[model samples]
Target: MNDDLHLRIILISPPADVDFGLQSGSGNKYKTVQKQVSGNGDLLFVLSVKIKNDKDGNIDFAGPFVQGSKGERFIYIDIGTYAGNPESEWGRRLKIPLRDIPVSVIEKLQPDNKLILETRVPGMGKDGGPNCATVKPFEGWHAVPV
Candidate 1:
């Protein structure tokens, strides 16, 4: 392949309540993972899903490939963290780099599709506690509000 593909996978858009004004990667958390697919069917996984902030978090990923028998294919990404609330700022925005994802996976995600976003907060059950938020992005990415 002469050129590489790039995509901004969006997990969530920021709510109106956030004060995410003029910040770097100001909208959504994203990880820039990439794969270079050769015409001969070679694939390379470049990176893993990462958080947008300084905190430590982790995620998992599976193929940007085709399922031959069933004719079903998709990229699998799972992210979970104690998504802290956005008081002065937001925390733990996650991202999936489009270039890292195969076009096969991108085809599966369309607008208005309801997908599950797994989450846990340090104190979601209590009052005066921090809440979590959404993540998305492009190249030169940063974890920002969705």
Candidate 2:
């Protein structure tokens, strides 16, 4: 395994919007959803990264590995922190700061090897109002030819 293989984990933050839902009455009355906003909140996201083995021979990919029912394959990653916004709105869109993630591989893979990555962000709520939304990376992983 090389030093680059050790750098295979990355954390990134994307853009997000505030979602507002209105409660309507039968007599043309409506209610607005009230929620508390703060600037000291953090956004977290999880990523799943998989390195596929296609070519012949032995290859060691440097990254976290989770055991599965089928076999000892690679998939999904657990990233602790990322980037997010701190704007408050009833229902609006806002651009927030994002985090940077970098991944390195120590070992080399065979030919036709593929890598897949997925990102997931948990939802948060405040003051019994709607949960805060978060934006994450579109794709989690990348593939490299060894």
Candidate 3:
């Protein structure tokens, strides 16, 4: 839980799995590459963390995101979808975009040593699936600078 990690938050377009087809059902086996991040659909913002040896550690899941005037703008994860399944690393990791994020919210966050999207024990990801992310933004995720 070191709080000095650097993360990069980027607004990304949820790419379609050219290999699995955009509508691939319960299973998304194809891996994604940076050059392949194109196409359209819901926006997904991801926290790109630098892990050991400078390898990029990806923090997916449409959990807590760019906060808004009303509250923290969190995204929803379709249960059992490609997002919920971490295997879809190359594509849709279920993250929310930052364009919709406000400047005020971004100012309140700090980075951590590593990437670990936090999940509460009594919450969805912990007990059941990432059920609608019903509990809203998973609480303990540290991100990189905006």
Candidate 4:
């Protein structure tokens, strides 16, 4: 992977059943325009995510949160979501808002050049499937080249 390429992932929560009434297509499609990052070489990959609640409920969009190393490791920008109910298993799902996640390779990795990005619902099973036994604050992991 080229160090100059930037990777970004953003999660968006659509209105309940409203679908924004846009084109009917993939469930994980993004409606926003592609964004570019300057002074970084070039934008290589961009991923837009749509997180939906299995049950009828509301998800809040808080903003963007940063995860992983500050300079060396890849950065995860969370769009933010409303806090789910602590008592209800189905209601505890975190909602990520719609936006562009910006990723840039500012430095070089120590040993490896390839990075892997992974995401999962915290306290859930290997698959992201919903289950009452699972807990909230789903966990997501992202690995990127330095």
lDDT on C-alpha atoms for all candidate structures:
0.25, 0.28, 0.29, 0.26
> How do the residues 38-126 of candidate 1 rate in per-residue lDDT, one tens digit apiece?
12221222222221211232122222321111222122222122122224333332222223333334333333443222221121212
Which portions of model 3 miss their true places by more than 4 Å? Answer: 1-69, 80-130, 144-146
Regions of model 1 farther than 4 Å from truth: 11-13, 19-89, 97-146
TM-score of each: 0.21, 0.21, 0.23, 0.21
Instruction: Tell how far residue 14 is off in model 1, in angstroms.
Output: 3.0
Candidate 2 global CA lDDT score: 0.28
Q: How many residue pairs clash in each candidate?
A: 15, 17, 6, 9
lDDT of 3 by residue, 6-61 (tens): 33322223234421111122234432222222245322323332111112432221
Residue 45 CA error for candidate 4 (Å)? 12
lDDT of 1: 0.25
Q: Report how far residue 118 has shifted in candidate 4, in Å.
A: 1.7
The residue pairs in collision within model 4 are 60-81, 60-82, 109-146, 115-144, 116-143, 121-138, 121-139, 122-138, 122-139
Model 4 over residues 72-128: C-alpha lDDT tens digits? Answer: 222232111112122322331222222222233223322356553433322222343
Error at 125, model 1, angstroms: 14
What is the lDDT for 136 in model 2? Answer: 39
Worst 10 residues of 1 by lDDT: 65-74
